[model samples]
Target: MTEPLQHADHLLRAEGLECERDGRTLFSDLSFSIVPGTLTRVEGPNGSGKTTLLRILAGLNDNWSGQVYWCGQPRQKHWDLVRRNVLYLGHRPGIKMLLTPLENLQALVAGRQQVPGRVLGQALEQVGIGPWSHVPCGQLSAGQKRRVALARLLFADEPVWLLDEAFTALDVDAVAAVERLLEDRVRQGGAVVMTTHHEPAMQGMRRIRLGGAGEQGPVTRAVGEVD
Candidate 1:
């Protein structure tokens, strides 16, 4: 709405990002750019803080110290603009279990956009859970609950997506569906930064590997084989 905060090339960029949790140093001097039309995988062992890093990128965590630039400027100076253009999906489904699947989705897009009920239903259908849309999420299976969360991807208008293990618990079909969705978004000039154990079916994915020994810090690589 406000002409997208005037970016030269990158949609999001982090410079010298450093953070620690429980006194464990997660990363240091971590710099990267999330440009349009690319898929970035945050690769790391368990407890390596992939989720923590995603939170920082999405503005959900402020415990970290570093400069995150939204559209090539400091995040603090234009955080509101940053918030508007990014869609974040945490590892948890984040659905209100007491609410129906439809209701959960309604709440997701409520303040962000004026999505109609029919459109919302279509999103559920696209994710292969339309029949269960009216049923409470508490009654849904693990995979179904994940699908409900995945449904939001269908209608989310945000250009930047920060997904944490988004493919977990999904069936083969559902995983493929989400893969297609990611491909579509990237083709349309959107950027996605995600963490997943499942190897993505999509090609040309860059990776940021965390943990292990390095004189400088954890390694974040781009478009190449392991070094």
Candidate 2:
């Protein structure tokens, strides 16, 4: 397991985040802190800008105004650090259709580190794609393609993860597998901020409900650390 970040505070924090689109306000004064060893669920009805909020936190969107801190430093000043360490998984499977799952994973960790083929294959097997690891991703079903993307979670050494609707195309068993992955990440002292409609069986995940009255995301815990 990867070691926890060395920070003495929240892994990531946002203050007074506000974003507007199409001449309408999506959310205002939103704030949250992602504590280590915890999962934060960004919840709201469709079109409430949960994805947008995540993008802002991940530094993928620049159209918003907010005070975002990474390891207690302003994110804008340390953008490279944030981008390098945080793994942002979008709603769609972000993989090349023409490449095999192994190839896609190779490209993902290309510049950072060299991984052995055996390790890559083990990651695919963990995600239930071992039987089709070498098949071109274009020929895989939707869930399989998502599994290809999900495999990166196994290779993640980052302290922070931003997942936008990662559960969208997964089946029951696959979703359960992801939940276990989340559990593992937290156990490794990582922080997770995700947007998903699926009610995870793992409990005590803090909720950030957008577009509601006074719903600015806060760092309040409903229970103790995840079991």
Tens-place lDDT per residue, model 2, 57-145, is 88878998879998788887887778877889998645999999999988877765577888889999988899998899999999898
Q: How far off is residue 190 in model 2, in Å? A: 0.8
In model 1, the worst 10-residue window by lDDT is: 218-227
C-alpha lDDT score of every prediction, in listed order = 0.84, 0.80
Question: What C-alpha RMSD separates each model from the true structure?
Answer: 2.7, 3.7
Off-target runs (Cα >4 Å) in candidate 1 are 2-8, 213-227
How many steric overlaps are in each model, in order? 0, 0
Q: Write the per-residue lDDT of candidate 1 for residues 1-227, one digit (tens) a residue.
A: 55543234788898888888887788777888888878889888787778988999999898998898987688889877888889999978579989999999989888887999999999888888888988899999999999999888888888899999998899998898899999998877788999998888787687887874335555544333322
Best TM-score among the predictions, by candidate number:
1
Q: Which candidate number maximizes lDDT?
A: 1
TM-score of 1: 0.92
